[model samples]
Target: MGERPVRRSDELVELLERYAKEDGTRETEIPGLRFIRASRITEPVHSVYEPSLCVVAQGSKEVLLGEERYQYDPASYLTASVYLPITGQIMEASPDAPYLSVQLQLDMNQILEVIQAAEQAGKPKHESGRGLVVSRLGDSLLEAVLRLVRLLDTPEDIPVLAAGFIREIIYRVLQDEQNAAMKQFALLGSRAQRIAKVIERMNREFAQPLKVEELAEEARMSASSLYSYFREVTGMSPIQYQKQLRLQEARRLLLSEGLGAADAAYQVGYESPSHFSREYTRKFGLPPGRDLQRLRETLGR
Candidate 1:
């Protein structure tokens, strides 16, 4: 039994390496699951992380959430229990052993269902914690993940079996020592859950001016309490969080829509082109035009 999980983990790594043949992210036939491959270390990529589980089967990666840096490799897994703006980089890779990983987006409803079914005793009282966490990956969880990935090769089994496997994976995560953080996302009315609602509102209305009182109301907390809890979970104040979302969207506009700096800035709710440029440079380490050019060259676009 001990050897079985190790063998399964090896098999999982081989399958991920084989399927992820290119140097970019790829979506599988299964919903909410994606694969990433990188033949070399990558530059920092800024984006919002949805509720998801990220497991590296080979190599290593790092994610920057607010000012905190989280590094993980094959021995561990990263989880984002809420939507968060983050910077991610592939820290180790090579042509001989490319980085291979899988990201599974979490469905909150499914997570709640798993928790209910388990009906575990003495569930911990919810406490505020960062939504992003790295936890030691255990053999049981790895075995369940291996089974889930194996189904990709046999597409016919996916419809009937994928849900069960995914549920098992979530169950494993919730039962782990890091369950407190995961519970924030699953338990109703937890501070993390309340903040998640506010985050959703921000993402949906990012272009509009932010009002802390409105956000506080949305989260059902007083403004001061909201500020403190928001900072606790996200490592940033409400305004800073909104700025990250805006800047990330502005970058997307520049790259995907081919918008000029000023245009992208205004489109994403920045009123001052120069102000936007300053913040953009500060966040991405390059002025908007230069950053876009570099990204284009790197992507060969």
Candidate 2:
């Protein structure tokens, strides 16, 4: 496929235009399904990605995880198999066409049930521990997605048909040749799953000092293996991951809670305001107060 899809993208554009019809993200009657519309290119926005499928109907996007970048448009779809801190920007959009996309969140139960019933007991392909991947949107997957989106117009039929369509979509994704990353995380005791637990623990306790040995013991991996696989799946070391979580939370505190810089720093486990300010500036390209002002102005519009 090329930069623009012809028939499929047209249908999606029509549905999204009617359903969303707004400038920001719109939640649908269907749980975990959302539509996003943007009239222009955007600055980088940071957020944690839950397990979900993301597809664009009329634009392209770039998602940054650690130092890795995943680019997708109408020709491809992206899946996040686990929770990940990511930065995303709309690379292509304008008042003429606008950027339109849909996201459907999924859980472990869905993936596990589908893979188990399919009897795909084989181990994931080697070196497929990454938590994020972009796969070409083949006909089968695209058709299934279209069916799921169509349910928005007939909420009456959704109760009976949505689950089946959702399962069918997952099944199609699992059948992909490069679905190893998704499979690894869904399979029990897989390295990726173990690392996922570590992520959960770290996210829950980001304010707590990182203990590599403790995380290693919990994941049943040596500190060395833990470091390697953690990077393999998350694209960063455990400490680096925790730092991002803390910084992101600190930023949120400053923005939403009206917390001062020092208060926010200590709340997120920073011992020194100066150190926190330095790291904050390094990561976000501004000091705390300046960034807060900038964010406020951005959101005010």
Candidate 3:
């Protein structure tokens, strides 16, 4: 058989390894970009993935959004236009050839700004779809991504050029064949916009118990319609969304502050410590104390 077509992914992977820092840690200075290098695959961990795009230059990953699973590799890109609770695991990583990737955080204000500009330019109306999507990678998109990542080497130029590069990336995404999904984020009165508002509110007050009626009213949709649309966009119910927000915060408190189980639970809005322990175990596959202990051990290793 003829030799398989050579993939540029390997080249990009090598560049990332030379430039990227360790995985699972956010770089201090960058507000909207993160580079990761992981020695081994990670367990599914919970977090609220905000609007963003993730490109895997080297390895692959699987994300669980509610019951739905999304897998993306070098040949594809993943986008989320609203806040979502997700469990993500690196499916392709190792010590010799670690997983390398960059995450570009999305800014709603910037998205809106682009939307207005596009509308003024008479961009065609876009159809609606799920709030999250994975699209096959394209050469132009990859080139833009590479340029954005490469800018890190010249720190002084970053402040001046980063915003323009980000805009270029977002513009490239808007011009893609599958642009409709991302376009929904820019439409002010669109169903996606309403849902995004609710997502923002949920993130802001995640510890408080949420009321579906209140949320529906805020979204200006009937309760049933809100339920259907929210699930259609986010793949989870309102209550489930709030629960995830709560759990993620509790985990953060436990891991970062070294808070005890009861204190962490109470701080995260759980009324009964026993109930918190049970739910935490169910969600993370271990009770708080043991789960944290295991995390510490893993870090040590």
Candidate 4:
């Protein structure tokens, strides 16, 4: 028989929506990840994106990681090799066809294991590149993802079998054109890992005052070299990274904790409420108070 016809995009869309409605209507927790189906506009949000892979079966989304922008659709997939603060919005969704997608959270141990396997298989030397990348989907990668999504249909078998399949899914990604970039994330002593270490420190203590010299010491690099490597790895300076962390936290406090703008600023390490207001407005496209107001109204808080 001839090769089986590839599934049409419409069929993929249907499968995604079906799984989404089942898993999305109620928050479903998988062993190592969380899955949700969302359509409404979200708050200007910033949170550490653990090493994870996100596939959008329908709709479009934009993720702002520091100064860098990553967008994905059905034809592409997004991967984050390290935990980083990222701002995201569901840019395309509607009542007629709400956003349909699946996210698989990654464990560092699993990633490290994959790295070892790839190395043993004589995978090419991992290239030096950013910790995050968006690449056109490969047929093998897409098929593997489709299989992972289909597992949701047989929830009974998920607990026992999902882990193995998830491993395969990641394996397919490693074989993609951009797999080398991801492999660098696995190499413990590589520059990418060093930069990831620096990011972990910054994320852990975003509220504390920062000294470039101190960060440089932690990363075992000179101040100037630290700046250069950090920017090269993350596409933003250390200070800008921290600022996104601060602003994202402040927004969360305002919306979730019901804190006022001034109080939120103080709590997030802002010395001047006005400075916080200016920066918050600049990044989020609205002042703190107004942004929160719109968020509450949009999300019906």
Would you list the clashing residue pairs of candidate 3? none
The lDDT-based order of candidates, best leading, equals: 2, 1, 3, 4
Q: Model 4: what TM-score?
A: 0.86
Cα lDDT of model 4 by residue, 1-301, tens digit: 1142146455567766665664243344356544456665444456768788887777888888776788897778888887777877787777776777767777756777876766633444544566677888767776776666666678887888777787878888777767567766666766666778888888888888988998888768799988887776677888988998898889989998999999999998999999999999998899988887888887777
In model 1, the runs with Cα more than 4 Å from the true position are 1-5, 121-126
Instruction: State how far residue 205 of model 1 sits from its true place (Å).
Output: 1.1
Per-residue lDDT, model 4, residue 141, is: 72
Cand. 4 Cα-lDDT = 0.75
Tell me the lDDT of model 2 at 117.
92
All candidates' lDDT scores? Answer: 0.88, 0.89, 0.80, 0.75
lDDT of 2 by residue, 147-173 (tens): 999998899998899999999989998
Tens digits of per-residue lDDT for model 3, 1-301 = 1122124555567667767656664562446888777888887777778899888887799999989999998888998888888999999998887888878999877876776776732334543557778888777678777777777678787888888888878887877766566676666777778888988898898788778899999989899988988888889888888888888889889988989999999888899999999999989899999999998897783
Candidate 4: clashing pairs of residues: none
Candidate 4 least-lDDT 10 residues? 1-10
The positional error of residue 278 in candidate 2, measured at the CA in angstroms, is 0.6
What tens digits encode model 1's per-residue C-alpha lDDT throughout 1-301?
3677668767877998778878899999889989999999988989999999998888999999889999998889999888899999999999998899989999998998887888852357657788888999889888888888999999999999999999999999987777576776677887778888898888899988999998898888899999999998889998999999999999999999989999999988989999999999999899999999989998899
Model 4 residue runs over 4 Å out of place are 1-12, 22-29, 36-47, 120-127
Q: Of the pair 3 and 4, which is ahead by lDDT?
A: 3
